[model samples]
Target: MGKVRKHSDSESDDGEIEFKKPRPAKKKKVETKTAEKSNDNTRDAKGDAIFALSNKRRVTVRAFPNGEPAIDIRETYVVNGEQRPGKGICLPLVQWKKLVELLPDIEEAITALPKKK
Candidate 1:
């Protein structure tokens, strides 16, 4: 049996010690100035706007239970071109606004009427 030779540390394809340095990481692409500006503008616009309810009777503004801002409105009553008196029904603000916008001038004139004791 011949002597068992141990593997040498310094060995290469051409039998030379090779020391390899790690390659640098690749850099990410940067967004353009106009793109960044547009992004900022969108963020600002989003921040300024909110889902809110504005109606003739009453306006209620708050965030939804799911964390989204929402508006709830109460509808007004009308009786012979006069606004009826009492608590109104609740509806989404957008719907209420659209209803009023679509309603005739006589209907729009009706607001939260005075309550009689």
Candidate 2:
């Protein structure tokens, strides 16, 4: 039979049920290698598909399980000298292009908003 889970009451007569330990989850590999960026914006400390928005925030392009590259604009914190992703949005190519196309309108909308001190 396939793997079975026996209740404690059922296993009491048969000594005990030995269960295999669960394996640890595989870790996702992260790279921050340098490469030429098309944008005029100079490369940050972590170059290539990543650009720094500030000391703690940056934008990165990476592919998910589906192999489609998405732009992740997220906050990061250092862990053993590596930048780890934090809360952020991952925009697919289509949405990213739409955002680019709406830059003018977005700017105008921002301009219409009341100023805050």
| Model 1 misplaced regions, further than 4 Å | 1-57, 67-70, 73-88, 105-117
Best by lDDT: 2
Clashing pairs in 2: none
Q: In candidate 1, what are the lDDT values of residues 44-89, reduced to their tens digit?
A: 1224222213333543444566665455444444444443324644
Give TM-scores for every candidate, taking all chains together and pairing residue i with residue i.
0.22, 0.55
Best by TM-score: 2
Candidate 1's displacement at residue 70, Å, is: 4.1
* Model 2 lDDT, full chain set: 0.73
lDDT of model 2 at residue 74?
92
Instruction: Give the per-residue lDDT of model 2 (tens digit) for 17-108.
Output: 55766777897665433334566754444443777889788888777669887888998876754666799999998999999999999999
Q: Provide backbone clash counts, one per model.
A: 0, 0
